[model samples]
Target: MENSFLNRIKGKEFIFSTLLVAFVTVIGSFFRGIIDASNFAVLFLLAVVLSALWWGMASSVFTAFFGVLAFDFFLVPPYNSFSVSDLKYIYTFVGFIITGVIVSMVASRARRQAIETKQREARTAVLYRFSNEMAECETTPQVIGAVRKNVGELLGCSTAVFMPHKDGISDAGSDADFPLDTHEYAVAQWAFSNKKPAGSGTTTLSAAKAFYVPLETSLEAVGVLGIRTADGRVIFNTSEMELVTALANQSSVAIQRAVLTEKSREMELAKKTQALQAALLNSISHDLRTPLVSITGALSALSQDFEAVDAADRKELLQTAYDDSLHLNEIVGNILDMTRVESGNLKLNVRPCDLRDLIGASLTQLKDKLEGRMVAVDIPGDLLEVPVDFSLMMRVFINLIDNAAKYSPAGSEIYIGAKTEGNMAVMTVKDSGFGIPSGDLEHIFDKFFRAVKPRQVSGTGLGLSICRGIVEAHGGKIWARNNTESGAVFFIRLPLGDAGHGGRD
Candidate 1:
């Protein structure tokens, strides 16, 4: 139950004062015959002390007034009437009143100081609680929501948090009931972007309905916090502003920590992936090379004994051995290229080169595979030269051509074209083959990624990945897009070299 002001005044101290006054009156009445004038004075002084001890100065003054009245009524010479025949009784009453007033004055001053002290301690406790709650928040949204709720309770206001967004500022946890206006959002966005407080109590846009304080840390402003007092005025006093700023700083730190943690996780995952790729490369290289070496050695030995071997057997052995070597070489190359790319060790020797020459070299290298496939090349004489690493660029074209041949039906047309687009030299290798599945378009360049439908084709699924790495190393980009007219079109875009340099070769 609440202790009312009157109840506090009439508590134990008030009762004690009343009882003491009554006791003194009774004693004076009983000792009237035995007690001398000096005894009355002593009894009055005892009453004054009791009043000061039990009832504070004000109560003491009241008690002294009653005590004087009792002294005269029951112990004065006239015996229990208001009439005091002696003038000394007047002196005694006056003396008692003066003492009570002095005591009350001193006690009242002490009580005022004590009350002020208690209020200060209460405010300190509130600030401590606010700080503790803010420290426990982790993300920007969490911190904003917590600050809004706590500030609303602490300051007795409707609080909102406005975070910076691409369009403007959005309220952190606002519902339909607390819709934000466009001007308020714009104002909040301005405050956050500029790291300044505006609206209401602030100097900038003081007429604004709500107070906006920038949530800033050491690095930058994270967002803005807005508060509206119950009376519809902003309540961003100095202390309140300081508390809000502190909360905002803590929030910024939390956001920064979260971003750093996410980046750290990404780096760790990349490291583990690199380690796995290295192990796989080691295994593939070892397993594929052993049989390849043995088969090649057997071929050499048989060729030396050609006269002793049957003609048909020698031809079959030579052909089988040749095909096996090619397959093993392709697998080994894919593994090495993948490992290099994953380790970030692939280096490009970029120079201005003719796209026609690059395409021709790739075609020559894959001639045996493309023997039954129809190849069509369309290159203008005035086509711009592109800056690229000749050897790696050729390999990219070779991979694309070989992939096209493997997927295209026998005797299907394959198109190779070079053209210029804006500042880029564009080369497209298109084939009338089974189009890439729509779901696999994005992952086509990912290591070890292959479409399920293409499983029948022989490949380690690293060809496109290697092609991407090589093209990117030369400051170019390669991508696959399904041609509306026919099969998939693999487009390579390389920055055009200076006209005077022709093409880096």
Candidate 2:
């Protein structure tokens, strides 16, 4: 607002400088007898000085020229005439003109210096703001956005950042407002290659539509920043060009930092992937070998001493071989299920199946494992049939029951309950066993995760993880929680309607 008021005052001084000189001439005429021509000359000089202070060199010089004409026409001895009776008066006129011109020149130079200082301060402030915005950028695209926004606001022009890639320069999906044509691209390429500015308002390729500045860092040039006004011409003063170059340099540093950060993240991910593969290979080899060894040893003993062993001893050895074979089959099955789930190939054969029948089948399958456990079933008789993949869901119940039996003490009551809640069928398998650690509850369903408790229990830790995958693929949710009194409870919620949302092929 203050600048506008000063501009208005300067405009008035330029437009009315002649009027001021004329006013001084009238005063001189009024006091022609009282005031000598020498005193009148001082009054005209004061008018010229005022013009130089307010309106700059052009207006001040204009005032000085007209003041000379006014003095000769209205105040000189030969009033309103150019003819001078004495040639000595010509020296006085010459001296007056020189003095007026010198005063105007001095004042005009001072005013120009002040204006330049103010403009430099304003440009510095703008550069500070652009620097602050660049500091918050964390990626190449984000840096490009900040550049476009700041440069456009600074110069009232469209802007873009062209980055080098395998195929020369590309915008890298940044939707820049400034479009680069063939000529403009050539100009931008020259700027980037030479690490200098080109195109409009510059010495090189001055006829191009846009101006291009190289985004150079201490290391090397990263890209080119292109600028174009709406009229297809770029123009800037010294301060503005300096500001553009400063922004480009800051952005180049930021882009380099972002690129390095991305590469660091990728390296970290590669290290993690290597570690996970090693862990997987180790776990599979150990689990696969243990059950195979047990089954081989049991069968080898039975084959060598079938007649020598008593009837009861033969039955015990046969049972041991059967159990180990089942264990071996389970390990292979869990591994296959995990592979299918991880590869996104787990398709569901959805069908409406009764909760009681599913639970009964799972219990029957695990009859040997749950031999010493007391099973308590509390499902409502008229409970609605849940839409699910029958085999996948039966496996879910089997895993839950087997896990409970393995963890709990002998003869402990394992409760299985089911009921309808809203549009869902909620089933829970709970056991009176050592509850999961508070920290491990959230990670229990993760692949290869085993609890710290019950280290003696034997099996690969893929059962619960597979169960979770299968349940979720059937459009259901599964979770485990510690009971208020003791032990842990596993809950499964499945949609009771059509299986449209399930992972069906």
Give the top-scoring candidate (lDDT).
2
The CA root-mean-square deviation of candidate 2, after full C-alpha superposition on the true structure, stands at 6.2
Pairs in steric clash, model 2: none
Residue 432 error for model 2, in Å? 4.9
Compose the digit string of candidate 1's lDDT tens values, residues 1-505. 1134345556776667778888988877778868654368567666666566545565677677777787788888788698988898788778767866776566656665675566557666866776677667755566666777777777677777766567666776652333378877777777887788888777888777777777777766656777777777444554556556665565556555544565688899999888867866765666587658767776986968878888888888787788777787888788787778767877877777777888989899989888977899988676356777788888899999888887777799999998887777888999888878888899999876776446447677789999999888777899998878668889998887674133333
Write the residue-wise lDDT of candidate 2 on 457-500 in tens digits: 88788888999999889778999999998788999998888532
Off by over 4 Å in 2: 1-55, 66-113, 180-187, 203-208, 304-325, 328-330, 337-432, 441-447, 459-483, 489-505
Q: What's the lDDT of the predicted structure labeled candidate 2?
A: 0.82
Give the range of the ten consecutive residues with the poorest summed lDDT in model 1: 1-10
| TM-scores of all candidate predictions against the true structure | 0.48, 0.72
- TM-score of model 2 (CA atoms): 0.72
